[model samples]
Target: MAGIEFEIMEHIGKISEGKSGWKKELNLVSWNGNDPKFDIRDWSPDYTKMGKGLTLSAEDLKSLKNVLNEMDI
Candidate 1:
């Protein structure tokens, strides 16, 4: 299945700033040389109920913005 890809730097930044509760929401799929990938479906509370996952929460977006603002990103 085609999946969304995210940069590791961005991911770590989000984790550090609590922008995404990803650690609690999704599982990390790592590779040796290839870029890591994540299945958005895995993060959803109702994966079977819906065809796709929910968007990031407003609080999460705000937190992400705060993190990005604080850092050079």
Candidate 2:
């Protein structure tokens, strides 16, 4: 059977711009996919590249962001 591809999370924003080809940096994400959970990763560079990253709970993700933002930098 044929299946369709869909996005799991809503692309909220990117922490920074990536270099040319296969080198994306941090990304800000929100879940909107099937059985969604909080995730963090490079988001595959292309159809051939896999982005390195970690997955966290929505609460965890939010707390992490808050802590990072709270830093007096």
Candidate 3:
């Protein structure tokens, strides 16, 4: 199994990853890391590492954003 290459999922300043080969990752890969989709991710911590991950399509992401924004908290 190879390591996952992560791309920043949001404009959270920098994309700081764990120490090399140390802690697991939870990447929100988008556009194959080309024209990435910097949408907020919603899933478990080790989604990719556990062989299963929740991938939100562009529309889905938009809906999620709307929902998040509507939140009062």
* Candidate 1 residue-pair clash tally: 0
Q: What is the C-alpha local distance difference test score of candidate 3? A: 0.48
lDDT of 3 by residue, 1-73 (tens): 2655555454332223344332323344654456554333333344344333355667787898799999999
* lDDT score of residue 43 within candidate 1: 31
C-alpha RMSD by candidate, in order: 10.6, 5.2, 7.2
Q: Order the candidates by TM-score, highest first.
A: 2, 3, 1
Better of 1 and 3 by lDDT: 3
* lDDT for model 1: 0.37
- The TM-score of predicted model 3 comes to 0.36
- For every model shown, what is its TM-score relative to the native structure? 0.25, 0.55, 0.36
Q: How well does candidate 1 match the true structure, expressed as C-alpha RMSD? A: 10.6
Local accuracy by lDDT, each model:
0.37, 0.53, 0.48
Ranking by lDDT: 2, 3, 1
Clashing pairs in 3: none
The true-versus-predicted C-alpha distance at residue 39 of model 3, in Å, is 8.5
Q: Write the per-residue lDDT of candidate 2 for residues 1-73, one digit (tens) a residue.
A: 0253334445555554467544444433333444555545554455234455675767887899899999999
Instruction: List candidate 1 segments past 4 Å from native.
Output: 1-54
